[model samples]
Target: IGSRFSADTFRIRDFFAMNRVNFTWIDIESDPQVDELLKQLQISEGDTPVVAFGNEWIRRNPTNRELAERLGILSTLKEEVYDLAIVGAGPAGLAAAVYGASEGLSTVVLDRKAPGGQAGTSSNIENYPGFPMGLSGRELAGRMTLQAQKFGAQLSTPREVVKLEFENGYPVLYLDHDKCVSAKCLLIATGASYRRLNAEGREQFEGVGVYYDATPIEAELCGGSLVVVVGGANSAGQATVFLAEHARKVLLLLRGDDWGKDMSRYLSRRIEQTKNIELLTNTEITRMTGNGHLETIEIRNNRTGETRMVETRAVFTFIGAVPHTEWLPEGIETDEKGFIKTGSTVMNSPLWTAQRRPHFLETSRSGVFAAGDVRAGSMKRVASAVGEGAMAVAFVHEYLKEM
Candidate 1:
């Protein structure tokens, strides 16, 4: 149980949802029986957001690491040196894990958060092959994770690879809390993060008023309330449709007039047909105003010089994505936008030390490969990422023969 406006509650809920943990949330402020339940359990309101497991154990506002450990989802390195180390647990990494482990390679997949990465937050994906009715991103990720684990792949969660070094021409990863691991061949599939909304007071209102993904937890908070969605991409389109079902009304704010330019046709058609979603083109948020949470936002029309106030409690941003490559080592070459360079691009880099040309997905360093949205010139799609991942494993086999 937790307060409706608590950021910590949102964080916990998001983490649980991303990890596919089944739990029900109770609002202490709204639930009539919460006070009595808390009294019986000897939990004060000050120590709220208590996580109860089967009526026997409870933790009040526990950290993510603590919760992960309790759920038995967190994993530790098993072998001294794994045959293959996959970074990021998104589609690319998970796909590689399934193929690598099935081929008898000792593989371990590491991710800072849950298995899904940004795609995990998607409400619905229709274009992916198979599944005519479509499926939620969490369900797809969960299935992929289970398949990989079924093939003997070790999936480690809530672990960040902070630094990288080389020992005997093999990659050594430095993780958080002074933990480190080594692997014969490394796969860099650490995907991208949603670009932050540039509106005023965005940072202050984050987790409280502003959000990046529209999950069921956020949907509950915005029920019967006005919510705003920003961007013109497929992510924004998906959010607009998903939240429109719960929110009283949704305002889709776009900086450009052509909303369908970056979004899929089906989503754009749905937005047009939805009665609750108001499409605001050539508009941008100028300021965000609220007392402690979010209350109102000032928006402007770039073409008409008209300004208006939009009263909203939540704002979901899906503008674009920036690769999570800042922590990557200098040996890996990236393009101007920081996406990892692979194949022919890597061969042209001065860091290419291998006598033979690097494989299709190989990076500048030998025995290292990159795939998914993190790689430059890659098609940013779930199917393509999965394909690249499986193909990268094929290249790993060729690289292993030389070693």
Candidate 2:
């Protein structure tokens, strides 16, 4: 009964579903047993989201780290050091951990949030290999996490690595909460985040009508309202398809002339075939207007120079990706767009004074590497990220031998 109005319930449900956490929801409005239990726990009907894990019961929705701690998966790092430290739990980091631990190296993988990164939030990954039927991004990431841990790689979540520096010959990282750790080698595989719209009033409607991701958490908030999805990539197409299930109408705004130019053939066909999905090419959002929540958006046609306002509460963007390299040290060279420089490309850097050229996927800093979307000139695909991560482990072995 309260599901429609409660964003917290949808968030909790979506997070659990994505992480593959086994848990049940009790409405308490219908079940007498659950109602009585809620009464016992002093959780009234107004408090709809009372999550229980093991012996602990949280009155409010739990964050990802809190859930991990309750489930006994978040490991305590303490003062323990490692042979290799990965600063992201996306595909690249997970692959490195799986390979690093299986090859007898002590590895620790840390992520600021949950393990899946951006790819984990996807509803269905049809293009990824071995999954013809298209399993969820969460399932793939959860399986990889388990495989990494199965080989003895330690994972710590919701832990942010604020800064990195070189201490002696090893790399040292300072994380949030005054925690310091060191590793012989480091991998900056934080990947990329969803780029935000540069239109006016875009910030005011965030979390209200505009969202970067169209996962169920955001979809549930739209509540059959007319939705507008920006960008023409596969991620935007996926969001459009997923949002169409709940949104009354889905409008895809493409700044380019051809819809299929950036999107996958399959997704383009699906968007073209969908009845409720409207495709507007050479379009761009000029402004967003609302009292507190986004009520309308003004769009411009780049080709025709015509402008019009549309009624839409939800706007999802899946445009270009910007790498997460701000926290990286100065020695680790990055492109103008902040993607880490790797392989022979590092040879162009003045920092590359070593006798041997940098190994493929190795960053400008010796013993430091990069892969996935975070690496400069990398192919933005899950398979390529996995391949680079596994390949980086081989170079790690060679670097260690020289050490």
Candidate 3:
């Protein structure tokens, strides 16, 4: 009996194949009894890859190297605990790791997926300081990662925090499948996820054409192709301008009549002058059609009842972002939109406080703090996130001293 696989599994398998790893390739999707075996293994819905090493059940994408290390299949198991565990590898998380580790606080950074967070998907960031020539978001993230690692900060990518519990005044993080580690201080910097389109065939064309982040590698696939960018925000404008260089043509779709006022005036001016870019106001994508890849998109003019079809190869949507705090238990004191609330408030308020009134970055649960884009009133800029990350560490220091 074989196991089912997901698109991520296929990608991982391809990567291993290129490395010439000895392994049998099986497509459980072609097997009739695969579903029954999946149920027996307690696999839930969603396309996931499963591997069976004898009687042991391994689900999803697991590296052979990791399996070897875990099962004493390799020479040794890597140490996992650290003095400071920074969740989320975005600007704030990266900054915290770099600073925390350099200050001699054994630091470890972990992210559910790949590093870079939302900023990692950015095509280019022109506003971050110290880069007069401007830098790609991926490049910036890579540099930060390198700097942190260089200073002895251990970073674990593609790791998810299944559970976080405070044990004896220390934060204990549980990894996938019950692997646990305790830390002196914990920084919740998991960042946010991009809002997805609620249209049909959207999931089918995810990597084939639909992308949330407009990175350079993703843009490379759009060479000579027509690309559609969704949203009126700065991210959308930046992606539109970036894709214009590689794509044959770019369409900027905005549900509102005007572009977001928060976008830089310089970027708005550049968008207006870019002939390859077409600005569509008061319009939205109604539906997309393709066999396995995106071939055409149907857009609707909200003000007018007219609909239009554009043959595009790729779609980059930056409609908005939502906090990735679903794993957090209730009573965290988030706003209506789910952003974590910070700052001290009036006395005798319902909000939990460690030592003062309104708690600063402290969650509804005492001692737990939130920072960066996940926190309310965050500036949401790369520089701002970095600053907040370092600031959060200071608060953690204070919180520890009080404890």
Candidate 4:
């Protein structure tokens, strides 16, 4: 018998344990005698491993990759139209979907790429609550997606929203190639994008040797090789710590003298104790050189006017992120940095003050709301995003009721 829970089976465990193989194991072995019993029953060949699900032969020595593809577990088709249309399938959007659908509102979530915005790119998130052991950003996003879908939230991936407009007091969302979707309400959960270095050859070597976010796919390319990470904030510090675990050496290049003071103290201490990491202050990448892939990065020391070349297989940058709101209408109130602005009062609150007024998460344009990293004054965290998303929905209800 085969199980789809544990990885105690030697063959299946070894196949996934090898980093070279890009496959995930989902099952475990039940009993050695079961294999022989199946052969005796003329159901399977005794020479190879076999799986039986209720007297039916499901597989024979099948690799996990093959099983995943055959079972349609890799990808599935998505439906269109929803009562509540959510743009950006990150944490905020997923949270809203769960609450909206569970509350009997038809919800639809769309994303330009895979779910889990900037937070998904993280290798491990230790600060999130409820998990003392810590969890990967990918895992957290996956759980949220499952929870949302369980409550009837529809998800559409690899779809981009091109424009947003209002028709008869209802918000209409437009996708690439003029695909339009009208909804009772719209939530701008479209998170932010990382700012690129714009160095020569940086574009050409994007997937081959350069990456904006440190993920498992990018980390695998740095096996036993030197890696360069550029940034000074929490993201940079996190990347340096994550890369240092797999790479032979990690060079952290900061534009200033010290790590961003806002970085968590525990993370700062870990980076200091890690012997494999090298800290370079007041430095910047001047250029990059490679034919098909990146071989060496040229750095400029701002203080000494000196240049140095660091040979490495891969470079990960986490400098900062830019909000994705260019398509939004100009009438919508936003901060100087382009983040959506909300009123300084809680929705449906009876208390009001002239100076210390309550602000709801309503965007400059009435009836439109912003949440998560896309909203101004938002605390960039998974838990915080969920809270903001739920609160925004309450405001949306109030906005519609008054209108």
Off by over 4 Å in 1: 54-56
Tens digits of per-residue lDDT for model 3 on 1-403?
Answer: 2322234544444333322234655546475766786687777535456555655656566774464444442222145556778889888999888888887878888776555778877777887889877787767777888899899888775567888777787778878755676787778898877799976678887766787867654675688978999887778878988999998899998888857576877678889999999988898898899865688899999998899898986888888779988777664667778887766622344756456654476666665667788887888888899898887777777766766
Local distance difference test values of all predictions, in order: 0.90, 0.83, 0.73, 0.71
- Give the per-residue lDDT digits (tens) of candidate 1, residues 187-250: 9999887888777887878888899888787898899999999999888999999999999999
The TM-scores of all predictions, comma-separated, are 0.97, 0.88, 0.80, 0.77
Residues 1-403, model 2: lDDT tens digits = 1233345565566667656666776654455587677677777777676676545556466666677777776678857568899999889999999999999999999998778888888877789989898866677899999999999999987778999988888898899888887999998899998788889999877666776777766775666689998888878888888888888899998888865887789988988888889988899999999875688899999888899999887788888888888887788898899999888898878988778989998888889999898998998887889898999999999999989
Give the poorly placed runs of model 3, Cα more than 4 Å off. 1-81, 345-353
Clash counts for all predictions:
0, 0, 2, 6
lDDT of 4 by residue, 84-123 (tens): 7788878888888888888887888878655677777777
Residue pairs that clash (backbone atoms under 3 angstroms), model 2: none
Residue 264's C-alpha lDDT in candidate 4? Answer: 79
Report clash pairs, candidate 3: 344-358, 345-358
| Cand. 1 Cα-lDDT | 0.90
Question: Candidate 4 versus the native: TM-score?
Answer: 0.77
How far does residue 89 in candidate 1 sit from its true spot (Å)? Answer: 0.6
Q: For candidate 1, what is the TM-score? A: 0.97
